[model samples]
Target: MPYHIDLFAVFILLGVVQAIFLSFFFLSRENRKNDVNFFQGLMLLSMAACILEIFLMYTGYIVDCLFLVDFSEPFALAIGPSFYLMIRSLIHGSVSRKMQLVHYIFPVVYFFLLIPFLIQSNDFKYNSWVYAYHPNLPFRDVSVGYDPRWLWVTDHHTLMSLVSIGIYFLFGLVEVIRAFKEKRESFFAPVHSVLKKLRSGILHMTSATVIIFVVKYLNIDDTGDHLFAAYISFTIYLTSFNVISHSGFFRQVALSEPQKYKSSGVTADAQKELLDKLAMLMTRDKPFLQSGFSLPELAGKLNTTVHVLSQVINDGLGKSFFEMVAEYRVEEAKRLLKEQPHVKVEEIAEQVGYNSKSSFNTAFKKISGKTPSEFRSA
Candidate 1:
């Protein structure tokens, strides 16, 4: 087969375009606390690495020869954990600082090990580990040589990296599944299948990594099948795409005790504006649907503060945040039960605001004078 594409240039252009849009999506930046911010920055950095990898491919900077190979050293290494962190954040609502530090261990060690090679190259020379020559023609063969140490480091790094990401995926996958199971028991989301989709995404990423490793082992240490390796690299990058695509990251950001709602000093106009926001959240945002949703969560997503959000829900909505949210959830359950008869009563509990099935049932009974099953059966 003739490998006739300039994958180096094409990959870079494609990645840069995606990164630019990703940056735009991150502009609002709601999850800006501690490890969340770090993970977000890490994602951007990973995408930058992909962009750099592309540059290296086009410039022949990483390879000693004139071709590209399948195994990515530092580039896709960072990208893998970034995906893991994104999923972790989505399911758990936070990142582990200690784990994030641990995630960097192998990549940092690899960078140091490569320093000797990196410094030896100048603008005229390539500072790369995997390279090939005469790619993709029937008569062509690719040749790639690495620092003897790379054989050890890259091999160990691949294993270590895959394990780290698997731990993260397991972390998110378990919580998400558990959450769904609880929701199911409560008779909420009886037919909702997001749980399966989340599991599938994690599995797909793992499968892609495994496939890459198998290809690497067979590709013969970066010298043969350069184009085939490029194909694998492309697959790895696509996996990264799946890891970050979601609305889980979006939040309403709330900052402080707004002077606008202050009883002693807030201006009438300011109070009016805040009241409008409060009304808007209840009607438009429907934050009540979130099970763990609280004043702080709402405020954080809104980029505001708890005191103000509390005041809005209380003073503006004429109810406490809990009551406001609970009321809406009950109404939501009623609507779902009425419209979607096939869904079970346990599903209604989860689909609304209750975490456990029992909690959902209790809340539903308390509010509606009917257990979820009774309500559904009605």
Candidate 2:
């Protein structure tokens, strides 16, 4: 078998390489400890596998390696579930084990269904590939010594792939919408700008996948697969660009000033008054208990600007806004840990405005010199 390469193949191979790198980056020991990173890494890996298979087929290299034919079908099936899990982890901080099992059922079943094809002879697999891609070339009659009905799922693999991804796409979109609604913020609001961008990216990627699959299905063969592969490459490039742009590596650093707030016109008396009001609010209302509580929201409640509130927190309280909030939260966690010893540490984390236990533990240890468990045990 002869291998072929072209500009399209080269472009797609570049994407494949980048996707694989990103997958490993996210799955690295430092990153994969976070559930969001774990799921996102799995999604990227699945996508990279699918794109790699497409690249090999497009370049006519799969003909020489018949055993690798259609090997990415399970990975393709996995893409949707991983994507949905990543979104869920992002919004909720972690996915339950049951939810992960439920989401992966289809991929697991699809892999089992492909066992027959996977075990077929090289002649059979080669004919399958040739029939799908090189239709104009000479044909070879081969048999797998079994009824083709055993592989009915593979016969409709394209439709199944679309349906799988489409369903998960809906699931992910609904999750995003629900998160926005729960926050009581409009889609146009800046409070959820991160989630808004995530939703936008997922929407664009899913929409493009649907369009590409529809076109591939209509083409009735692997002829238009190069286009699908190219689209995947474009998405990979877009993802990489987004990551690099937001990584802050290229951002310019500003010089430190001796007196950062010297120009602030807030009088000493006004600062004392603002500090009193903030203290009252923190003690009486405990706005920090709200998981989505933010500096802007606190400013709104206190009838002051965000900058002023930040200044008051930093200068008057001698801590940054987040550090102040974390102190309050950790204090609350300490109370809960002592009074409700039977309650799980995870529950305490949530009650104290933490989205994940790891963050709660870090903040607790930072402020109290003990983890929540250690504090509770003591």
Candidate 3:
């Protein structure tokens, strides 16, 4: 068989490369600890695999490697579940192991069902591919020892895939909706911009996939798969562009500011020491409990310059000085709310160093996802 290549094939090949790269990028050890990254990595890998198979078949490359034909069918089933799980992880921090198992069962079963066809002779698989994708091509005569009942499943795979993806898309949409409702946030809300983008991206990608599948199947059955593959490539490119743009890597850096604390003179050792001192101060003295406690006063207590203290809190702890104080205050407030249930919310707020109840309510809700009254009542 002769090889075929075109601009469409090239586009798809590039998308496959990028999708695989991003899959590994997200799955890398540095990012694996994050549940969202882990599931997104899995989703990307599944998408890359499905697109790669489509690319090869669409470009006639599979003619040279018939044994690899249809290898990505099972992975196609995984795309929906992985995407759903990614959304779940984003909203809930992590998906339960049992839920993961349940979601993956369909893909696992499909893989098992595909094994028979996968092990068939090259001629058998080639004829199968030709029947589905290239009906004009001459079919080679081949004999199979037994009937592969799984062909029934493969016969309706397009519809099955569409339904599978649609079901999971609904699941993911519901999950996002529930999360937003519970958090009192909306997709249009200015807060949680990162999460909003993520949710919106997932929905758009999944919905686009569904539409592409429907159009492809309706217009040209399996032969129009390249169109679907092309869309997947476009989705991958869009995802990559979004990731880079949102990463802030290209944000303008002010020449005058240079680094955040280039002149602070705080060495790594001193930063760690300051962080330790800050932690000890919070634990031992609970200075955040003092109403109107100021950063300068905390710096004075730590015997460090305000700039150095700010750097310590921001760099070493990954939060601003005020954010760290707020966290401490909220934690103390929670303890008081739980242990001293009879205490009024105002008294608890005052005890946690907030001069006003409204300010305390805001901080408590921001950190704990609930107001003091709601938390106490729960």
On TM-score, the candidate that comes out on top is 3
lDDT (Cα atoms) of all candidates against the true structure: 0.56, 0.80, 0.80
lDDT per residue, candidate 3, 1-378, as tens digits? 576788889999999999999999889885665667788898889889988888888878788889888888878888889888888766555677899999999889988888887888999989878887778899999999886544788656666777788788888888877867765776666255435655676567666767676776586657777777888888889889876755534555566875875355566555764565567568878989998799988876665567777877887989987899999999999999999999899999999999999999999999999999999999
Model 3 bad stretches (over 4 Å) = 149-151, 248-378
User: Is 1 or 3 the stronger prediction by lDDT?
Assistant: 3
Name the lDDT value of residue 160 in candidate 1. 53
Every model's TM-score: 0.49, 0.68, 0.70
Residues 1-378 of candidate 1 have per-residue lDDT tens digits of: 132347555655555555545544453354344333456556655555544444555455444432233233565566567666666654344566787777667667776775544444232123223223324323323333545345565446546555655565666566666756754633223333334444555665666556655655775444332333344346445645644543223322345656443333233343454554455556667777777777887776544557756765566667787777777788888899898999877776677767688877776788889987788787
Give the per-residue Cα lDDT of candidate 3 at 17.
98
Q: List the residue pairs that clash in candidate 3.
A: none
User: How many clashing pairs per prediction, in order?
Assistant: 25, 0, 0
Candidate 2 residue-wise lDDT, 1-378, digit = tens = 578798999998998999999889888885675677788788888888888888888898887788988889989889888888888766655677899999898889888888877888888888778888887788677755675437668778887888888888888888888877866767655355446665665767576777677777778786777787778888878878876765534543445644554446565555765676677678878999999999988886665678877987888888999999999999999999999999999999999899999999988999999989988887
